[model samples]
Target: MAIDDLLDEHEQSERVRNWLKNNGAGLIGGIALGLALIFGWKWWVQHRDQQAQAGYAAYAEAVKAIGGDDLKQAQAKVAALREASPQSLYAQLAVLELAQAQVKAKQLDAALATLKQVAADSPMKPYADLHAARLLNAAGKPEDAVKLLSSYDSPSALEVRGDALVQAGKLEEARDTYLKAMTGMDVASPQRRIVAIKLTHAGGTPPGSAESI
Candidate 1:
């Protein structure tokens, strides 16, 4: 019985030692992995900030050049920034600004081209498309403008497209489009009356026979 008791105690000691030995490796590994994750996150954040700062700097230089009426210089700087950091906010804004500068220079074709490129490249394609629609309208391509505006989700574009249709002499279509605009807005009485006149010319009856817009 004495020998049996000694063996049982030795077995208990061995079991405890084994448990500690196995669990020690796991505990140390878990701590190391947690520290690595924390440091990795910090490094990633710092890198992203550095890239953003660089992109903004390039964009600012472009804007300054544009303000100085040096459009060629501005275009060069913006192109470089966009090429280097296509996904940056500054890159997107730079393109939009470049298009505006081109418009001011009476470079309508250039502006339209730049806006189209931005529309294809940027995440804010709808905004670029809106500007492109305006450019098309100003360029005397009302049909093209109407088509592009029709593709947008914004209701204001509907009004714009309706105006284009009216100018293009598609009176029936324009009337339909204008009524679609009045569907959601609080049209003033005077505007409603104007719409009624337009509708009558377009071979349609106005709401309430003389309703305001």
Candidate 2:
């Protein structure tokens, strides 16, 4: 071939070789890092799924123990599940079950303490607070129940607050709260009838009742 063409080809080959030599280590490192990340993520997902399965097994056992009225065994299984998988959904459910079992056993203080362990950000927190408020009311601490439910505006929460207010002799406020609760509740709800009775008992007329009309 021509000398000029041969010289040009030789120069292009040298340039390609030089570029590879300069960037080879970085390219290899990038590939290695990509592979490590892919494998690491897969391993982490597998480990998480395995942990969830184990937690579910433990939670099921705890529930079975609770149903069988073996409180001690249920408590032990729940504690173990909590210790082993504190952040798991199954652990949270197990704690709620344990609290219910405690409440059924008339261990009010223990139930409250168990409910208190529910994380504030957990979806279960509102239910836990509801149970605690009921327990407080049952224990004749209506003021504490009112205070505990003060942050919530749900119909159920408002109903509980109204009950507490009635117990505390704040009849006017109780009537107002019951009215609000009824307004928020579904018209067809069975609980709405109960709340209406409470409102009338507190000297308030329900919105659609003949007396209110």
Mind giving the per-residue lDDT tens digits that candidate 2 earns over 65-157? 878777878878888887887767787888898999898899999888888878787788899899899999898999999999999999999
Candidate 1: tens digits of C-alpha lDDT, residues 62-173: 8898777778888888889878977777888888988988998999998888777663656767788778877887788889988888765454566667667877888889
Cα lDDT listed for each candidate: 0.77, 0.88
RMSD of each: 4.8, 3.5
User: What's each prediction's TM-score?
Assistant: 0.79, 0.86
> Model 2: clashing residue pairs?
none
Query: How high is the lDDT of residue 59 in model 2?
Result: 86
Candidate 2 Cα outliers beyond 4 Å, as residue runs: 1-9, 209-213
- Model 1 Cα shift for residue 199 (angstroms): 6.6
Q: What are the per-model numbers of colliding residue pairs?
A: 5, 0
